[model samples]
Target: MTGTREALDTAPTLDSRRRNIVFVTIVLGMLMAALDQTIVATTLPTIVADLGSAGHMAWLVTAYMLTEAVATVLAGKFGDLFGRKLVFQLSAVIFIAGSVLAGFAQDMLTLIIARGIQGVGGGGLMVTAMALIADVIPLRQRGKYQGAMGAVFGVTTVLGPTLGGLFTDHASWRWCFYVNVPIAVVMIALAAKTIPTVRPASRPVVDYLGIALVALGVAGLILGLEWGGSEYAWGSPMIIGLFAGSVVLLAAFVLVETRVPEPMLPMGLFRNRVFTVCSILSFIVGFTMLGAMTYLPTYLQYVDGVSATESGLRTLPMVLGLLVTSIISGNIVSTTGRYKPFPIAGAAVMALGLYLMSTMGRDTGIWLESLYMLIFGLGIGLSMQVLTIVVQNTVPYAQLGTATSGVTFFRTVGSAFGTAVFGTLYTGKLDPALAAALAGTGIPPEVAQSPAALRALPDEVSAPIVEAYTAAIDSVFRWVVPVALVGFVVAWFLREIPLRDSTRARATELGEGFSMPDSADRVDQLEHAIAQVLRREQRKKTGPPGPSVRVLTGGTVPETLVWAIGAVHLRTRVRGGATLTGIAEDHMVPVGVLEPVYREASQAGFVAIEGDSLRLTDSGAQQAAVFRRVWRVWLDGKLEDWTFDDPADRALLDPALDKIAGDLLDEQSSRPAFAPLTR
Candidate 1:
């Protein structure tokens, strides 16, 4: 229930070599998760033909999607509890297992069940990968990495069908599922070796009720959408009942969150105007973007007379636009720390692009359609990629995991709804239009549903169906224009906050090295005083009879003792930079001991490592200042009841204290008067 950053002295950081390995595994895992969403589309026909289950084809995706959505919310909380490395590893194992099951499926039911299981693991991998980056990378440098991740999404989304088609056309469609197995094996191997076991200082309490309510609510809503008009009439009692139950459940979820000690989705975060606006914008961007994307291929395939693979290629302009803009915007935000303008402009462009799409017809040229798509992609790129950053920046460090997951979860929900709503609109418009188009022709209405049949029909007969299809797609996009416009309006209200600086202060407040003279005598006295105070604090614990929970520091006070402990880990002689061996040589310490210490400093929040240079953290520096003051007062015989009436006293005392502290620490010690390490 408590919210706190890690205390100083135990500052934690992974070495760069390890950090890079973690990043690669995360990227590949995420790519695998992302690729599955689209890859199945190309293989659906082959799957249906092989399994003899046209009725079950859509569930192949729907089951995966429904389960994935639920898992994403839980993954964030689990990562915070179980540790990202373990959660990530488990997710991979499950995903690989699901993939294996899917590849070996004997029936449509088994494949659908396997995909749903895979979705559960995929969801964990996706969110944990994101949260893990926040765990390992310094915030200021994360933009490029986040940008690259976005580019991967854009690329995979466009390329998924092509990859799937290659597997289906040449090998068995089972390869699509089998491919993830090898990639996942590699991810798991690298993960176990490289990903840090970042266990939390305390175990978290799970809100089972809150999780259940949200899951049930979302499941009901999604199921309603999935079944309405497609599986059942919109007004059918079953669809109506699902929608009604979802509303009641969601309302109960909101009410419960307000009462919970640790809510899965904290209602209080909505108070932050930035999070509110960004979340709204995030939802709209997902809604319009995903819906538009789903239908564009339909336009290309039917109206423009292209193959599925060719349809994907034609959508490349839009994907590339999104890719280019995401990278550019990410770099620009990193350099300037300004981001509000991009989302605003991007939303506006997206609206215009959606509007432009509405104007296309059966005769529209492929190049011109691509031009319109490029504009849409530009808009999506500018806004969607940056939403995660803006939300992360607005929340407290304690809430980072929740806030990050929240935005993503909302976007996912939006994507699901977008597909349903747009699908309904497209179907409603197309059915009537096609029926009328084929009225006098010898062609059955079923012919209009089949691309091959429609393509082989006489020109007089096919032209009207194409026109009807183009019109239906135009109508679907026309509805999306307003959603994009709403986002544009929301973007104006998004206030930009300065991104947090890249420092270990947020990591730990413990000071790095002792700056005072190596005066064993003075340090001895100061250490005695600190130990006495700490002993008093530890004796004052009021909790239950169990393992005594020692208080290391005050809520606001940085623990000077822990800083001293962290400083003891430092080997001598690097002012700014040195090779590892050089550092080890200077202090006559083995390189192995120093490596772990450096990692401890990095993670403890005591020190930050920039390339070869290690620097003290803000709190670490503060602790050091306190050390100087402690020594200055003691040397002046003002230790018992000291007070500095004038601010000028610090300047007078600091120089004297440093000189005295330095002389004592370096020359005299076989061991310090007080060995924090031994303690």
Candidate 2:
């Protein structure tokens, strides 16, 4: 194995207590970052009242998501370079700074800029948090922990709007951002105390030009769409120039990706029909979900005459519907391995739900509105839950990291584009509709912009303003119906390939439902494949390949004694030093029981005792290396079914395999602890 792949397995191990603490700390950091994504939804109206640019409402979401999507890519690269602990802490600080700036903003543009800053930090938190998991958690326990972490995203979706409303209603809208400050401060403090500093084993090439051009290109398109009808005429030079410039930059981005050593997004993955169709469907899902989430609160507030808290409460039906179907669909996919039907059904139902919502008017009852929102949420859940799984199942192992991040990247970009388009549609329609309704009544347009202010007006006066708001919201939902239908058509083109056992095992994880920003390295992906192999063997009650080990090691060392030496080596490498008591404690064995094994090894000159520390001698190191090689041979046999056609992919697999071989040896060294140990 090459040195680069050897470094892939370099991670710091902690005692169970410290590991759990660090886990909780990073999880808190992730929760705060994710909550910011949707917390502003219910507060958009009140934010407009203070900052006073109603047309810029979508930018609050667009800026955060756009920068966040860019940040996840860069952060993943940086985490591999600077160390996740440093990146995580820096992210917290940046998030706090952005939160402070946003809390004290004087205008809409300032708040939007601050949100962009927050996005950078939040993106770092999200990506690094996932990376940190592989660094600290034991591979045996990683899947369960990852599934729990995935549930956090689902919880945030349900909580963000309601929490934003509570803060907006009782204290102030600024509290939504302000709340992150103290929670983040506590998280930073806890993280510093618990997380170990583990640097990368090798350097990774970052595609700086590719990342920059794509970011700029996407931003340009969003800008053109946002400003087209609202800030500039659709045919004016400003909007037209923005649109023309974006296309050129995107073209350049594709060109750059082709030449770069390691592109942020490999242009080659699009050649696969599965990846292409999934990317489009992922985009539509994000477009519809975020767009509706942003404006639905606005509709409930202005048209339905509800408080911020009430609006947030009313949006729960959709969130709940999404949560239910997400979990259900993920479970079903795991059991049946048939997934193509979900995206098709989900997109069709989404269109139906949007059409139902567009039909809502002043007289629309709360029950009917709830039902519409529920249908929309269910469709989103079904469509989105499987996109990542399908991509992972079909993409080459070498392209696993890029392909996974690419799916999320498109989803986030779609969210920004959707919000921009939704905003343009809303403001363009509302300006004219409101003017027509208020012209004869002599009411200033500004008075009707604030939901609370409009609610105080006489029934006849408020009725027209309400109708105008309803019409604008109706137009926004109606316009997206075709987009959802397009997703329905695209879903048909997604080819159903046989699911790998590794991918199927992953499907059982509930986190697949919530669709958070996922970035996994090649080593991590290899480990995932190995994990499934081990799980299957466990179920079959497979025995160890003891005779194979004996043959490979020339019968010079007993397998258990080899394991003893390897355990000491692993502990010394990971924990700085090893002691008899520490090793015994880890394995739930008494010092008396472990004393003779080390004593026998020491007598054989495999280990040397210096005071309380145990160190592997030259002979012991040689024996452990032999054992590792034997284990590698066994792992190769167990995983022989996974054959890569490309030599480059095979090359990537070798190093990751080398790393996993060493890890498997270390983990197996502890296996004797589960049974009665016989020296």
Candidate 3:
């Protein structure tokens, strides 16, 4: 029992295989969260008609977003309090339960309540999934993972309506909710197997007061905007009071945050110039991406006369543009170790694209519209992934979850407000234009208001309304130009902190300091295994002669190949590390040649040489582990008939086996030519 308990308490680690599986599982949860955001919209009319609850149709979406807004922030804090894996699994169960209930809901109210439950679970999935990657993956490898996950946003953005439409048309609308069950089951199973049980070492004080205030503040602000001009007049007492109360609530939340220990959003984070700047950029990016995407499809449907699914399909250009740029920018940042350029360029491009979109009118060709979308998407693509990465780079591991969630929270709020404000502005322009078009004409108000009714009208009646709709949408885009410009200006002030390589051991980057890889021998074993697997796959390809394995047999080292093999040898063979001077003596090489050899190894990221001491970097250590595995595999075949019960004989054979392994690599493949072992 003691052994079991100790093992359970050990720090969690995973090799490449486990990491990949976990990543996929997390994406599945994210897809479900994103899908729910838009999927219900396509089936709303059918849902209302079937349930006979037309008055509450909008609540189906509003309730979900409202709860989701609160859940996103709360989940991050709770994950910090409890273990992330526990919270993540609980979220899956809750989301699954919500799906079951939503599918069985008898009334609009029941469905709305079910949706709100799902929102809570979905928010947990989103925040925890993001935080888990930061926990397990080293910082250097995070860019590609983050980039690929960001592309999930693009996929969900385009596929949500399309998938919902197919389910509603082919099967019952309930299938839209039911479909999540299987996918989520698979996700839960994967997470259970692949996710480690990780808990923070200490539980911080929970700021319940601050949490309550932030939740209320966010709810009031969203409700105020969501209801204004639709449910209540902009000047109505209810709307005015909600807005005023929201301000007071938010101000109080700020005060509570300052006073509380372990505030959900630590005020001190804002003092980090990177966090502040990135949060603002994240908000603006969300504003433009969500706001523009929302109205673009509306134009396609109302004016271009496309069906719901066709509207989804028409937005593919933007999705593709966003996906391609997201991947490219991620790879660039990973390789170049620079991030400031992408946002600077992205902001400028985004502003340009929005300006171009504002110029589009009803008569714009489909190809021209796609081009405009592509440009806008390109701009969004460049900036969005970088914001999250930069913030992750800046925050300490302890505060990582909060900083990430904060960025996400602001983005979501910005999206909600952007959509509302854009709608308010568009409708404000549209009403006047619409009234003038209908004046002195025999069109009834109700028919003109109905999209289907308006479309059925003669060209003479519909033409002016289409023109008015075109102008109104264009005005919305034109108004958004300033928001993008603000982001562009703000991007200039963003400090370009050198993104530290997490693979290189640093006391500061690890929140627990020097007590990580050294204190936990298990981490060394896990790293060793992870490196072996990754190297086995890569070593299959052909390579030029690297280090000569014959160097083991007392041959002169080649100037050309020595650095390459010597780096690997130093990492894998130099066990129980000796000082620089001792290593020179052991290798029978002069300090002069070894100095340049160490320099090559350091530059190539194989090892770190601090003063006279030497140790492998994370990358170098992994490669050494690979070498160990290769040696083990070859040595196993040669020693099959031998028995070494004695330590003295075992010790003698170990050196012989290593030398033979080196010779095989040099003679057979002119490289480290060991055959890749089967897992």
Candidate 4:
């Protein structure tokens, strides 16, 4: 029992520290994953030559892409179920292990398998990082942090290829894989030390069927695109079968999600207008961005004959544009608390940039290329952070993780599909251009026609093939420009609602008894008093009432009691024959309280029954209203200077007014006047 108690006492402290650690670990892990995807691009030629499998070169990248795409949605759901810390830590371990395996791989096939393992871990890292941030931050403040994260993403993209090149040139290409090991180790250690462990709110049942269906759907679609025109013709049965399978599985996944008690992807989130619109816009943004970005390096290397380093350098303008714009836009959103215009403007700018880039050729100026990239980056930076903020604001805190992950998942899916379709277009156009370039050369058509055979040729044969590659890639951007324009149209529909910073605090204050200095408090008091008066009248009319009525003044009646009296009078008048009056012959009490109460009741059309001898008709009630209003104003001025500092005085007066009011309002028909009020 002592051991158990000690363990329980330390658990909360341990959990708190662990949670912070987990967050840092996840951030670093995500950085590693994102960096690896781009960093390896610069080193791919070296890797292909080293492994002696040039024909299977694209598989090295495709394997990772396929696994990462399929794992993101699954990991998101698991994080919500098992606790984000657990999934995040597990992802780090998996990523680290995959990195070690890839570093030790002897051939391209082995390296591809290792990358696939890393992709699974990479998917978890990205999804869980987003979901965890949503858990810790309030929605209103989330935009600033998300902007900071976007800056980090931009930094990674800028540095990844550069870092990879440095490693390949200075060290060995294997160090690229080994590099993640230390980062992962440090991240895991810090996470275990600082990351807090929040126990799941309720035990979550794994949606095995839903998971399987979604995975199959995404996997089939990505596989079909990745291999459709490259490994098999577009008209091949394999492509058709995979496409059909993807659609069927996606349909089943939707059906399962809609029926589940606690769904992984709840349909209810789509009910919010902002969430739905932002999600669609996020998808389009990702689609347009990935489609164009995927081929820019190819264009530079093939068309301009630039070295890999030079190609990366040419993309710096876009990175600079993203960095500057995201920081400025984030601060503006934080200060102004508005976000609608950013997306619309960003999409328009991106469309313009895409249009400009599509007009590029073999001899396009380097400055012009940089300008187009800068414009595209600026547009992306402005809109990306705002989309996450919009989605987060529209949902409850508990659903933040789910909603965020859902939007992110769609974005990733769009990126994957966008890259695949555009790659197809580039290849489709390149094959013909290559054939035309090789026309009438004594070289056989079969050798010139094949990418592998063409790559093996001398510099003379390879130059034209490279030129064809550039022009075909440029055609892909032509299509992307229009897609970005469509995104602008979608962005235009995003509705802007001002974020409420103190929504929760306001709700709490209202739940308590605090009231602001306004007529609402006074009116509320009157309503409460009227309710009490009606209840007493009701009991008197039906039950025994054994109290004598008395005329009293000079007291602060409980606000509720006053409202009850007003309510009773209003109800009595509405029922067609009742009246009330306060009889005071000599009193020094302020009349503000009773005057307003009486005036309001009369205005509501009540007759006054005063001292058992004076009764008010409609005209008499109207005549009394003028005196009531004038006396209330006068009494209020005098009462402002008066103070009931003695608790005993307040105690005695409060109960006295309550008793007098209760007894008077309870009388069904009689209105008896006691001794005249005295100061």
Candidate 5:
């Protein structure tokens, strides 16, 4: 009861202007987090120059993504238990601290550690921002705003590399990290003033052990791959120990999930064929996207003699291709509800793109390079946009949170693994090749390795070294071709199923194509899904009249008055009293205007005017209850296209419908448009 009271106390009371401001505040937070995902791509070569460990460079991106992946799962649960507003603010503070630390770092180790901290905060901001949207925005308007957020996500993905390069070339490479500080600081201030407090209805079980096991197991495996031939011998005790330890820990994680009351990832989800196949495809998508983004700039700078800024700009073909196709594919799926062909075609294109990229050499034309990149990105867009939608369409409502997070988790891990493996292959090939080419040339090994220094040498002296860098990078793409082919083969096994109406509606948002981790419970997700449909239908303006519109209120009774009665009953149930002035003020409407509506309701015998408070009479209460049922029925009808195979799903869905009905009734009833009950 106290929990419910706290939620009521902090419930949104924002006017439209203030709500928009809150939306902007959270959007900024989300932008900062997403920006970091690709911002380091162009800066990697420069950072390696200053820090002197090119071999360990992949860890910069890996550390950030790995920690961010773990943090998203933890933050989602924590936000649910504590509150989204508090979590969002704290995440901003942590991000600021991490950014400052990273900017001041003196060595590769220190920079990597700071980046890990940044990842944790960035992950928190992303998940909490999504949750906060459900808190402040009205249900009917949420979909358009969500679509706008997705658009912002797409823009950042294209712009991140260029922005990072701009900071590095004009200011200092450190500015790439320093740039987050002021933006995050402003976000925190705006969040404090504009965002409403939203308390959770119940405490959730935090899977601390499960998260740790997966994090450690994954990190250990990545460490073994990263260090195998570079830091240590392949057969060394340290490498063998790491690989062995990871297997034992991962096996233990499986056992722990089966017994936990609430696991981070439920073992049961793997039993479904679609979930298994989609997870694999998601991994390949991450592998290709991040792996190329991480190393392409290196090849451009080292072999092609391009500036870091130019290198970033040059990557735009790929990003633009990804964006255009993502939006187009999403719309197509929404219209036709058929999704299997996109992944199959996407994987084949991806394999073709990789094969073309592996053919690049010092003499390759710039146009050819861009065309290859565009092909690769197009493949990613087609395959990625529908994975989450299909998963949500197929999974039971009870497992929605875990299932969504699980797919995202796999993608994040794949990104980390991809970066690590690329680094290993590049390093392994580069070292021996560089030594062989530089032998007896009297040029220092370190000087030949540095891009700036190598370019300073005469062509006759630098030609061999350039060839080595070109061949080494080409080897990375060559190795990854098999991985993409595997994804292509797996994509063939994905079975097409009918899209739930809610899922079809949701697929129109391009953000799903980016596959960012979203952490929300089943009810919040359902509300969002329905909100999407509501928005789309609102545009067509063609749905049949609502079931409740005619039957619940006779031709004589104003629909507005029915709404007023429901609000009164809700306030009385939750807060013990409801005054006309209180309801008017909460909605930021004029008290005098709403007074007549209450007076009319009283005259109709639906409410009693007891001093300053309004109380629902027996008839009023029963009428309110019936209208709520009407809304419940209307909502249930929207999901008529979805299947509920398990009894447990219905058990979870039934209560969720009741809560949404109460919400819709209260929110609709309180609007100023409904002030004149007689109308």
Candidate 6:
């Protein structure tokens, strides 16, 4: 990942206009997908009223959601398998088609199906947008871009309902669908031109079975939640069966992924400590974001009697806070190249904000809402992009795409689950409140309390229903506080590894690039020299392998060439005493090589000859000991294991000793035993 940054730094910079164009293209593409999610919520009433089927109102949202949830995982896999750009563009096309179809839908069923198609596209857009940003931006600069993306999300949240309401009131509600068409077309064109193409270094085989299991598991779980207690009783066999099936399928998916050669989700990525921690942090981020964002506007609209437009407008404070902080944090991360501090601080701030917001009631002031939203936004801005940067920087360049996509997948799953759980809690709270309020007010207890039943009522009947919703939504925020606090705990484990120089020298030293020098080269050269010397010494030792020669020397002189030449001569005469037999055996050579030279020395009256032993004269003994001492010092220094006791060390020492002995013999054989040795 640091390599990516180094590459980017060396690449030519784009002009302001080109950079803006690229940013705007991605932002608009992101907004189209993000805004479509919530825009339909405000327009749902008009659609139901026009189609006269309030019974299927939730399905309008549920279908889009279920398809989207499934799409996120698939898109991530395909983005990695193919290229992110291709999948992203393809998603845009699918979304545009869905938008056009929804705009002209003839019935609620058609519209819901169209929305599902749009969701398939939406999932692709969301995942690919992130992956593409990661591809181009260095880890240092990524936070700023991520922050900018967060701002786009904020803008979409503010605009979605407002635009939906405008379309519902001033024009046909279908225009809400049409609004995406032009934006989608423009984004597609810009993306084709500006988005660089990238392919994985090696293609990993897609796990079709695992993909099926994942999609089925997520779909079943989402369906069971969406329909349980509404379309069917919570205890109904169909709902129970679906939930059970979801668990089984998901378990199978995990098992299958583990054994696959190249699993869509690499299990190894989780082994990285930083990646693991960041993934947990991101999951909590998603949980908190979805859990809180899902309910805040509902509380404003249903409990506080704010119009859809007003609700959207009221969210502006949160949006503004998020936008400002996200951009600021991103820029800071880019400049500093450090990220650990942000997640820690951000999680703490977010937890504080949630804790404060959880204390709100029906009488809570707008100013308080604004304050909580600002604080919450700041916390999100600080942590969100920075965590992404942390995960990217921690992994290898080869695994960058997988690591980034894996975190994204977990976060999205968390968002979906958080939304489901929070929605369940909100509705669970609303049911009893509605039942108590409408018990004696002439409304059927079941009809007054039900989510689907509440939507079916006239505006006059829905007022109390909205009141019930506001209380329920506020109750959901109370639950979000704990989730954010848990996130804070996880953020503390994030490790901070310093980014260092990106040079090849540093990379090689750190075991990242080049292979080190060979260990056997010097050893090989020493071995060959030793073998040649040993062979020559052996030839001289017994005169072509015949019987060993006995040598006699006079008392006045040193005997053999092996004893009186080079290092051997110097060591014997100056430092240590030596016998001819000791020299042959200690040096691992034959005495025949020394015997002839000893006979010559005796003939020259250099050493005393005895029956079993030769006694060196005083001068000869002194010279012999000095020569022996020098030879021993030279041999001991050259032997590899003369200083160590290991087997490998001894093996190295053996070859070195042989070479030393051979060199000494060769030098000695060239001159007289009494010749003075050169320094």
Q: All models: lDDT? A: 0.64, 0.84, 0.64, 0.58, 0.84, 0.60
Q: Model 2: per-residue lDDT, tens digit, 1-679? A: 0012237435655667887898899899889898999999999998987778899999999999999999998888888778888999999999999999999999999999999999999999998898788777766666666777778866885679999999999999999999999999999999888887777777888888888999999999999988888888999999899889999999999998888778888789889999999999999999999999999999999999899999999999998888888878887887788999999999999999999999999899999999999999999989989999899888777888778788888898899989989999999999899889998898876788888889999998799889999999999999999999999999999999877666777775556665678765767656655565565555566564222446646888766567679779788766788998888777777788877778888998999987657899999998888777876786787666565889998887886777777776776665554334633
Residue 452 CA displacement from its true place in model 2, Å? 1.4
- On TM-score, the leading prediction is 5
How many residue pairs clash in model 2? 0
Q: Could you tell me which 10 consecutive residues in candidate 6 have the lowest summed lDDT?
A: 510-519
Residue pairs in clash, model 3: none
lDDT tens digits by residue: candidate 3, 1-679: 0000011122333546787988898889877987887787556545654674433544566566556666766665566668677887888888999899999999878998998899888878876776665556533244456535545745675567667657876787799899989998998998888888766554546667887887788778767775687668999999999999999999998998888766767788899899999889888987787677667766665677565566667777877777667767766675576888888888888888888888887678989988988899888888776776576566643454466567766776666667666766666677788788888887865555445566688887788877877788889899999999999999998888765433111111211110000111112222222222223323455542123234322254333333344344443342445355755554445666567766766787766878877767787556544544565564454334344455763564454345434433323321222212100
* Cα lDDT for residue 424, candidate 2: 91
Candidate 6: tens digits of C-alpha lDDT, residues 129-229: 75565554432233355546655665664467667766776787798889889888999899888766665443445567877888789878867876676
Tens-digit lDDT track of model 5 for 216-284: 999999999999998999999999999999999999999998888888888889898899999999999
Q: On TM-score, who's better, 1 or 4?
A: 1
Model 3 / residue 234 / CA error / Å: 3.6
Error of 4 at 4 (Å): 27
Among all windows of 10 consecutive residues in model 5, the one with the lowest summed lDDT is 1-10
Q: Supply the global lDDT for candidate 1.
A: 0.64
lDDT of 1 by residue, 1-679 (tens): 1222131111134445666777888899888987886677656645654674443445666566667777776665576677778898899898998999999998988998999899899888876776566555533234445435545655676577678766765687799999999899999999887776665554556667887888788778867766677669999999999999989998998998899887777898899898889778877876777676667766776787765566667777887787667767766775576889988999999999999999998777878888999999888878765676676556554454466556766776676667666766776777678778888887765566655567787787799989998898899899888888889888999998775322111111100000000101112222222222223333457421111112223233333334333343333321233344644444455666456656665676766667655566786566445444444443444232233455564454445346444322222111222323322
lDDT of 4 by residue, 1-679 (tens): 0000001001121123444455556568668877766666556546654675433444555556657765775665566467667888898889988899999999978998998899888877765665555444322233343334444555675567667756776787788899999998898887676665643343445566876787679778867876677678878999999999999999998898888765657787778888888878777766666555556755665566565556667777876776566666655665576778888888888888877887787668998889999998888767665666466455553454456556666665566667666766766676678678877777765554333455577878777766776677777777777777777888888888764332111111110110100011111122222222333333447542222222111233333223324333333433343323222111223444345545554454443435322245565444333323333343233223223455663453343334323322323221212112111
Evaluation by TM-score, superior candidate among 2 and 6: 2
Candidate closer to the true structure by TM-score (higher is better), 4 or 5: 5
> Residue 648 of candidate 6: its Cα lDDT?
65
- For candidate 1, give the lDDT of residue 50: 65
